[model samples]
Every structure is written in C-alpha cells, then in structure tokens.
Target: MIRWDWIGRNLPEIRELLGDHIVMALLPILLGLLIALPLGLASVRWRRLYQPTVGIMNVVYSLPSLAVFIVLIPITGLAEQATVIVPLTFYALAVLIPSVVDGIASVPTHVRQSAVAMGFGPMRRLLQVDLPIAVPVVLAGVRVATVSSISLVSVGALVGRGGLGYLFIDGWQRQFPTPIVVGIVLILLLALAADGLLVVAQRLLTPWARARSSA
Candidate 1:
C-alpha cells in the first residue's frame, strides 16, 4: 500500500526530513559524549561521586520524554530542536556515564601501575593508557546511546520538531499508511547504519581488544 506518485513528488521533503533526523540524532550523541567524558572522569576520580551521579542520571532518564518536552517548552520554546536535543542529551548521558565509569574501571590495576612507573603523568596516563583500554566498552555504550537517540528523536514530532516523525503525524491525520511506513523504515535503517558505523569504528580503534577477545 505505497504510493509511488506521492513518494516521487515528496522526495525533496523526505530528504529534508531525513537530514533533520540525522542532525537531531547525531548532535545529542556528540554533545553527550563531550559532556559525559568530563563527568565520567570526575566520577571515576572521586569514588563517592559515582553512585549519586548515576542515581541522578537514572532519575532523569526515567522522566517521560513527553513530559520533558512540556517542561522545556517554557525555556526552549515550542517546536525548537533544542528542546528535543536537550532531553536526548540527558538520555545519552544516562547510558554513557555508566559506560565511561565502567570502561575506565575495567582498565587493569597493573596497567595503571605500569603507566605510573613509566613516568606518565595523570593526563598522559589517561590519554595513552586508560582511555585506549576503555575504548571497546565505551564504544559499546555509544552504540546503545546512538540507536536510542535516533529512535527518540521521533517523539519530538508531538512538539512539531520531530524529524521524520512529522511524516507519522501527517499520515495519521490523513489516514494514510505510506508516510507512517516510510518513517518507520527510514528510522530503522538510520539506526542500523549508525550502529554499523560505530561497530566499524570500534574495530579500527581497538584492534588489540579484538585480538584479545578472540583469544
């Protein structure tokens, strides 16, 4: 039950929506990673910060996405991409903070000692030793966050900012399945493509980890 005529006519609109969807999805991921790195580092450095930080993030994560949009509208305004981006950033953080903490934690004690013995200072050790070892775990969390962000960007349609989600609303209003089906298919493909890219990145970035895991 697809309309080739409609699809052909609306190709430009569809491309615009897809571009918006990609931006809405990827921006939060980039922002979340930037924010999560510092926070994650702080949490790992100060042992007591880990639990409360994660607890707070979990609470934020549990908030309904719709509710967040409503709450944010006063500040970010209705139908603004910022409203959508802000909440998705928090959701990404929820998955990523734990991943960051656990990834760094997974670095062996002996490795840290080795770095210290080699005269690698705190920053050097973090850059050269800890983070490199943590890449696989962090990338795993990133994959989850990326997929989640892509899916959640659609919810923004309720606020008039949903990327491809607009198609769903349009289809529903007109009682047509074409736009709805197209939205779903595109979202699925986007998520898969994004996740696949992350998998490739992980392999390239952490070849040693792959060899170790296989062994």
Candidate 2:
C-alpha cells in the first residue's frame, strides 16, 4: 500500500529534490554537448579519425558509472559534483559522437555539391548546410543521453549526490515505500518531460522539417 498522506506532507521536500535531480541530470548533458560538438565535427572533417575516436568513446562508455564515480572521488573528492558529472558526461559523449558523425554524413551529396557550387568553403558548408540538416539526428542522441543520465544519477546517490535516488536509499533504510515509489515515478516523469522538450525544441529549430512533414 502507498501513503498519499506522507507524500502530501513531503511535497516541499519532494519539489526541492526534483529540482536537484533536474540539475544533476542536465548539467552533464550541457557540458558533454560542448565537448562532443567539436570532436564530432573533427571526426567528420578528418574522415580517417572517425572510427578510432568513436571506438575510444565506446570504451569509456563501457565503464560502469559506479566505478567511474568511485575513481573520480580520489581526484575530485567525495563531495565534489564532478565525481558524478564527469562519468555522466563521458556517457553522453559516447552516444553523441557517433550520432553527430552519422547525422552530418546523412546530408545528401547534392546538397554538399550545391553548397560548393555556391562558393561555400568547407567551414561554411558545414555550418550553414550540414549542421542544420543534422539537428534532428543530434537531438535524437541527446534524448537518449538525457534519459540515461537521469537513470545513472540515481547511482550517484551512493556517493551522496543522486537527487531522487537519495530518496530511494532513505526510504529503504527507514522501511518506507512511499518515497521510493515517488522517486521512481518522478524520475520517469522527468525523463519523459526532458525528451518531450527536446522534441519541441527540434521542431522549433527546424521549421523546414516541420513544413516538410506537413506537406
């Protein structure tokens, strides 16, 4: 049985924890994007480096989040947020790099030719033509990264910073199920909300795609 009364009484705390959870899940994503963008672009431009770079990132992603967090504690200290953020960022990078490369590659050959015919340089063609077309694909990766980060942040609670995951731990130790259930539900809602927002943002950013879909 669930306790709505307990949940109602704890609404304020739940709200605060939800905010923390959002930050915990979101900050690493933003940081990872900043890092992934240039690397992804370089992978596309360099051609030969693509597979090797992606392979290395996949190796990093294979590392368990708990292990990464524990490993970072020695360097960043247990209380430092970097212990959690760094691992989540690496995970984000793994998904993003390949998506970016493929997204850019998916650009039509005729589009590239037309850009070159218009006297666009490599940089201009990439920025003006290729990246715009790649937005949907890149965003698809972002949605995955976000949901994964949200789930992984719970593991960070073990190190003292898991946002909603802390609630799960607290509930388990106290023999209470309300907080644990609430935390699970809230995390799911948060992931769905984040994903939905990304979809809306993609439509806004790529009006041409919206128009094409309507047609």
Candidate 3:
C-alpha cells in the first residue's frame, strides 16, 4: 500500500515538507516559552494568582485549533502563519505554566531559606538555585508541548499550512495511500526525535539527578 518508489523519488520535496513541519512545531513552543516564563514565575511568586491564570490558559488551550485559525482569519488573515502559531502558543502555555508552577513549588522551603540566609538576592536565588532544580520538570512539560504541537501542526493544513499535512491532504484527494502513510510516519518520527532530544538535554542539564539515581 506504500509507494516507496514515490517517496524515493520525492526526497527533496519530502525534506522541505519535513522542514516546514519542524518550524511549525518549534516556533510556537519558543514563543510560548517566552510568554510563559514571566507569567509562570509570577504565579509561583504569588500563590493566589496561580488558579485564575491557569484557568484562563486552560480555556484558551481548549479552543479547537481549527476554530482558532478560522477566528483569526479576519485579523491575522490566512496569509501569515500567525493564524496557526498563536493558538499553538496558547496550548504550549497551558502545559508549560503548570509545569513551571509545580517545578518551582517542588523546590524545598529550606533551599529558599538557605539561599536567603546566604544573602542571595531574589533574582539570583531564582536564576541560580531554583531554576536549575526545576529544569527536569519544566523540560518534561516542554516535551509534552513539543509533541502536542507537532501533532497539532497537521491541523493547520486545513488552513493551507499543514506542512506534512499537505501530504495527507494530497494523498486523500488523490486516493493514494503512499502519501498518507508517509505523512503519518514522518510526523511520528518528528515527535520521537523531539522527545529523544529533550530527554538527552534534560539529562545533560541535570547531572545531579543522574548522579543521585546512579548512586
């Protein structure tokens, strides 16, 4: 059912599509992280803000991707990729904020007190002590966001920027199984690759955790 010959012949196009897919997925995550960092930090700093902030993020993230794209057409129009990226960014936020909040909360109270006793400023304590310990947990959330965004990017195809979803659309329209199969396989590969890289990065960044586990 797979047209390996077609895939073999179309390596360049497939590569381009894959590249688009990667961008579509990663851009949202980067933007989302930028927006989430401050908000997540604030939420942790002010315990009362956490509930309301997360509620809003959940509502925004719950909106269907396709519906978001459609709603943005009037403002962003269909020409720019913002129509896709914005919604995905919100989705990424929904996941990242919780991860950040939980990660920061998980840091022991003594650690905070010790940092303060050492005369570490709030910013320095947060950046030097708290953030490093939270990396593993935050990175786990990033992994989730990455995979979700990668899969969700295909939904953008309906608005004409589906990346690999283009293959799916074309395959479906032509009743050819190869392109559909190729699209599915490529997306799976992308998700796996992203997750694998995140895992490696987490281990690299948190060597203390690795040492503790090994011991």
Candidate 4:
C-alpha cells in the first residue's frame, strides 16, 4: 500500500499554497473574462471589435510561456510577475475570448427578433433571454479555462510562486520523492474535482440545452 504520511503532514501547507495559487489564477481569468466577455459580446454584436480583439488575444496566446515570463519579470518583478497573473491571463485567452464570442453569437437572430417584438430593452433582452441561452456555451469555456489554469498554476510555482508546483520543484531539488508524489497527486485531484463539479453544474444549469446540444 502507498504511504499517506507525507500527504497527511503536508496537508495544511499544501492547502494554503494551493489556495493562493487558485486566488492568483482566478483573478486574471475573472478580469480577462470581464474584459474579454464585453469585447467578445461587442465583437459579435458590432463586428468591428471581433477581428482586432481576437487577433490580439491570439498573438498573446501564441507567445511562448518562457518568453512571456522572461519579458514580464522586469516590469512586474521576478518573484511576483512570473509567479501569478501574467501567465495566468495569457493562458485564459484562447478559451475565454473565443468562447465569449461564440456564446454571444450563438444567440439566434430570431431570438433577438422576438426580444424586439416584445419591446425588451437591450440590457433586458440580454439578461433575460440571450445570456441564459448562451450560458451553456460560456460554461464550456469556463470548464476549459479552469482546468488549464489549475495545471498552469503549478507552473507558476516554478519562479517562486505558490501551489503544488513548489512541492514538485523542492522535492526534485532535494532528491526526495514524497513531496513530488504528493504534490503531483494533489494537483491532479484538484483538476479532476474541478472538472467533475463543472460537469454537474452544466447539467444543472443547462438541462434543456444539453438535449439541444446533443441533438
């Protein structure tokens, strides 16, 4: 049987660090979602914002991870920048931006027509009709972003950050396998747990949409 002592001993420390990592990872994604969602909405709504914003996000996403970290270190400090938001936001784009755009765009034209027929105001229509219908698609993006970010959060630990990556790195450097195994296993469990939760969330929120999507 596999020993559980290392995991037991490290639980508090691991939880604390992972908490920080999750916080760091979440802010950028949330901020990016705030920016990317509106712009993505406008992109499909107005067309003018789509090409340029998409292009920019694509470029940012394309940059190599190490290269982005290297460039960011000077401006944000070696310890903080590489450790948290810079890389977190970069990884968020491919999922967040496109998904927001697609989710908004997927709002059928006839639905808009119905909103207009009912004389619903722009914001009213969006909140009551469009967004509700679009939520499943948006949730799909969040699922992707969250899982990817969880793993990347480990990467953040590389340059003196928090999360399980610290365990992996320190374990490697010290020539011990306990922390390494525990860390890797915990991170994997985190990702799996997150994915499972989202699956439940999607089913709960988009029960009707699931049939439509599957059909």
Scored by lDDT, the top model is: 1
Model 1 misplaced regions, further than 4 Å: 211-215
Q: Is candidate 1 or candidate 2 better by lDDT?
A: 1
Candidate 2 residue lDDT tens string, 1-215: 69999999989989988888888789999998898889998888899989899889989989989988998998988856777888898999999889888899889999999999999999888889999999999999999999999989998989988889989999999999989999999999999999999999999989998798889
Residues 1-215 of candidate 1: C-alpha lDDT, one tens digit per residue: 99978888999999999999999999999999999999999999998999999999999999999899889999999999999999999999999999999999999999999999999999999999999999989999999999999999999999989999999999999999999999999999999999999999989998896798899
Please state every model's RMSD to the true fold in angstroms: 1.2, 1.2, 1.1, 2.6
lDDT of each: 0.95, 0.90, 0.90, 0.77
Model 2 TM-score, all chains together:
0.95
Clashing pairs for predicted structure model 3, backbone only: 157-162
- Model with the higher lDDT, candidate 2 or 4: 2
List, residue by residue over 1-215, the lDDT tens digit for candidate 3.
88789999999999998998898899999998888888999998888999999999889988898999889888877846787888889899999999998888888999989999999999999999999988988998999999999999998888888789889889989999999899999999999999999999999999998899899
Candidate 4 residue-wise lDDT, 1-215, digit = tens:
33578778878998887787667767767776787777777787788877888788788777766566666777787667344686777678667888887887788999889998999999999888888878878888888888877777776655677567888888889888888877777778887888898889878877786788899
At residue 180, candidate 2 shows an lDDT of 95
* TM-score on alpha carbons, each prediction: 0.97, 0.95, 0.97, 0.88
Model 2 spans > 4 angstroms off: none
Off by over 4 Å in 4: 1-3, 81-83, 210-215
Candidate 1 Cα RMSD (Å) = 1.2
User: Residue 36 deviation, candidate 2, in Å?
Assistant: 0.9
Tell how far residue 128 is off in model 1, in angstroms: 0.5
